[model samples]
Target: METTATIRGEIVTFLQNRSMTINQFARISGINSGTLSNILNGHRPMSMHQLDRITDGMGLEEGYFYDLYIPECIFHTTPDWRRLGPFLLRCAELGKLGCLHRAARMTLENISYAPMLFDMAEALFNEDKHEAAALLYESVAECEKFQYSERLALCQYRLFVIGLGENQDENLQAAVYFEPYIDRLDDMYQLDAYVKLINVNISLQRWDKIVALGKRMGHKAKIHYQQNRYRFRTYEYPRKSVIFYILYSYLIQASMHQEQGDYDNAFYYVSLYEHPDWINKPNEEELLIIEQFKDWAEANRYMYGLMSGQPNALNQYVDYVDSREDEIFLALCNIMIAANRYQLHIDHILDRYKEHLVFKTQQNQLGKISDLVTLNRYTRLLAELGIYYLNSKQFDRGLAYILDSLEYSIRTKSDNGMLRCMGIFEQFRHFSSEETQRRYTELIQDVQKLSVYAWSPQV
Candidate 1:
């Protein structure tokens, strides 16, 4: 039997076996008759104190009713967080995430408990219960609405970071969440917020916005550094160097152009980061990251040359990327290299990584937000496999894979993936039958509509 049902049944049986009328039991338990009657009839739920009174009145142990009632009330009751906070902390410590989530949901409207709730949420987040922590943080944010407090900004920042591994919708929501607080943020948080916003713009293919924001961030960081130079010299440089944000902004702009397949523009943005004076200012770790990004941009530039049929470019780039361990960029290099090798090589590579790719794709799809890079990777893989099949004259299989790729790309708002699939469809149009060509034409039209709608003012 269910725990609640068993408890309810046991309570009724205890009253019956004791030969107690409702009024007598109510008086003994110090509960009103109607409340007792309602509880017995299952028309209302019992509170913690009411259950305790019943247990005590029946000469049972002090905590017998508490054990039965708490689990039920944790989810259903309007929380008195003063009473519930300790219980929730215990639940989190004990790894009872289900109970923790229940308590968080119940406590959403407890505005007075926002500080304690934020603390608990932070604890949960630190414990890697991201979804539960996000729920609690959201509750705190809602309860503390219209306040320009640090706590509220922290909540939005947490949501933004968590949303990065989710989907486009989550990224968009995170962007919106941080919008109002951008100007009020401290220097560090302001830079972080702009970086996250740039990421969202990249996923949405908002190239103009990415460039504009990048410039704005750069200008702001420059002014901030100029204003704070005296303080930095006096205090021995406690915070992050202002040059870090400026370099990061340049890297984001470079990535924006790279995503749009504009290698010249991408290289120009990378050149901004490579300026000698700016390059010399970064600390060790920051310099290492910057070097990694520079290498990535150079590798992508090589890939573009190979894709454009430049002689020996594939072999040269493959040799350069062969010794690298960065998984995502390495995967991109390997995929392109395999395409250059042979159809069988491409098939073998796809087969090897197929399960991992599908699992990641499904996980992202099931999440509240999708991972932008993973979605792009999965979609590209499908398109590549489709192209290979088409080249091998497997018309039906190729069409199925390409169409599926387009659907997935559109669903996730992956502009890169959609564009890739469209290119494949156009390149292979002559190989498909007339009816299939018509279908491909319709799909292209739909993709166009989706692109328009995505950027539309009404949307």
Candidate 2:
């Protein structure tokens, strides 16, 4: 066996096993990032100092370096993922959904241009959730709207997804493409069309139009009430869709203030939208988001501390947030997560956001409409617990969470949660009791089946 190869492999595996990146490790150990990478990859032999750095950084005794980095190729090079698992798991622990999503996305597509797109996506996603290439969504839309060229629709979708800059060449080009088809999309997707139009107006920096579309979409239910529904009536909407729209408007308003560097007012509006309104408090489906919110708030607080010259360490954010009252801290924590989810979604947390478990027995306990929101919240929590369990890969535990999500979905009038709730139930059906699996299969697309599961309006 190649002794050099074995030593290099061992060193790489050891460093990675500690969950430190080359950049992070290099910084910690007074080594150069590129040089460290080269050494780990076997291009450079370990210098005594470099070995010292690795060993010191790892908090291990001297032989640790030789143990890991000796013997020609005796170390089977760890698979790339074998090294990556630590980074990804660390990201998950930090509740850095963006980090986790970026890493997962990186691992997913092993194609040319994938790296560039993934890098750009990570930066954009971190700064703004709407930042995505959306090649997939655009392609799908083009196929759907073949009659009118899909370029504009695709552009509209992209602008909406990224949600920034009006005069930029790319954004303007997207706006130019979508401008022609603007008047034509009126009745097509109804409220969704209105939402898209508002998004397009935002790209063009036509705040007047953006505001007008918002008003119209807000009143759409009153103006366009269906035979109690739509052409896509099968698509259930959240009862709080208007509230959702309002929140979106305010977020954009907050972003505008933030851009102006008016931290006071920007944060004021952010707090307005972010405050835990009884009406808007997240139900159980969003518990991961809620938890992640705490993590990010802790992270942000830590970052702020570093900016203010505090020691650079993990619990930096947590320590700062703790200085604030627990209630204020929790509220801020929730806000961080909601701020991202408001525009687009990141994946690691998508399933957490989509937890679909229900408790038939507990749901039966919620017999009143007056209790709907509270009960829905409870059931949603149960669903999230399922999601938490499932994410842990405890198959049995996840199944139970899915059952709770389903019960909530069936009990609530919220069509918005359906996509999440139904989705989880569908996934769980295969693993659940045959009776639930059979019933859910029958109830699959039938919205009415939800009536029994949902709260009675009269109650």
Global local distance difference test of model 2: 0.47
Please report the TM-score between candidate 2 and the true structure: 0.25
Off by over 4 Å in 2: 1-383, 434-447, 450-459
Please, what are the lDDT tens digits per residue for candidate 1 over residues 1-459? 645454567767887898878898888989999988887776776665676688788888755544444555554545555457666665555456566665566566556677888998888887887777887788887876788788887787777676664346656676776766766666656775776677677667677878888888888987876776445233322234566577767777776765666778877877777653544455565565566556755675666566544666656665666566344343553454357444334455456445444525332111222356556556666776677777778887887778888878777766677787778777877777887777777777877887687689972
RMSD of each: 9.2, 27.2
Residues 93-192 of candidate 2 have per-residue lDDT tens digits of 3345454454444444343333343344344444444423343233334334545633445345444535433223343455456545544443334455
Q: Where is model 1 more than 4 Å wrong at Cα?
A: 1-82, 90-111, 163-170, 219-244, 257-265, 279-282, 304-312, 327-370, 388-397, 400-459
Which residue pairs show collisions in model 1? 166-369, 166-370, 167-369, 167-370
Best by lDDT: 1
Count of backbone clashes for each model?
4, 31
Q: What TM-score do all the candidates reach, one by one? A: 0.60, 0.25
